[model samples]
Target: MPPITPRKPQRRALLIGICYKHTHQDDWPELLLTHRDVDRFRALLRSRYDYADDEITVMKDDEAVPSRLWPTAQNIRRELDRLVRGTAAGDQLVLLFCGHSDQLDTEETKDKTEEDGQDEVIIACDAKRIVDNELKYRLVTSLHAGVNLTVRVLSLS
Candidate 1:
């Protein structure tokens, strides 16, 4: 048998949790434990998967600092762009989102994809709605070939 090569896949993770500090149309309840959930997942990534602290980008509403970005729709899109830019073949990217989700009617029905004619969205800290199609276009379609991307979304609503 020939010599075997070790599998050391390049792993990257983006963890986002929104507690909805502000709201617009709906009186959404604030999530007390969503931030904790992301923290726990971060721990798991480090202890179980050996992910470095610098390798993870955390965007939380209550825990937002100057260095760490906030969980806004614009920020999320920008981060997704950054992740796709840094990703290469055989690289692993994990995205985790914990917040409120809602189903809304989408325009441009000619290219409608959702089965129920309504688009699922993740509400951001600024009360902005990020449609599922937008996520797929920015994160999924932008990934390079052979890149492993996993998205975990935990919706409180």
Candidate 2:
């Protein structure tokens, strides 16, 4: 009798791109190519990485899409939680962020003992910030053993 091989595990991805157009701040210039970069990366995931449309979640701020897909701090956290909520071992997860980022001074951050005395944050569409500690708690610390996680951050600022 022939041996039976195990099936491949599921793959999921969350892609976020924010242009901050609605911020209306003179200092925050709009990123002209953020959305395009997200779209291209999404295409690559679908074609090269074998990720299905349903398995990938995209949040962009350039279009008049639903508020749920606006890449706000709340929505980003919600989607990230959803992405990591239910998964067995061997599952593969990918998170891609393309937009502006900033470093908050130690006094402004909850973790004051940072090596650089600053907390890194990703800027959301509503001008909110998602700190690195929050992301680590949601994505890294919550993952189960044998699960694979990939994170890519492309800062436009």
Clashes of 2: 0
Q: Give me the candidate number with maximum lDDT.
A: 2
After the best TM-score superposition of candidate 1, give how far the Cα of residue 24 lies from its true spot, in angstroms. Answer: 6.9
- For all candidates in order, the CA lDDT equals 0.82, 0.88
Supply the TM-score for candidate 2.
Answer: 0.91
Candidates in order, TM-scores: namely 0.85, 0.91
User: Whole-model lDDT, candidate 1?
Assistant: 0.82
Off by over 4 Å in 1: 1-9, 22-26, 108-111
Best by TM-score: 2
Which lDDT tens digits does candidate 2 get at residues 53-83? Answer: 9999999985666889889899999999999
List, in order, the clash count of every candidate structure. 0, 0
lDDT of 1 by residue, 1-157 (tens): 9998846667889999887765454656888888898999999999999999988988887644553488888888888888778576789899999999987876642337677788888888888888888889999888778999998999865
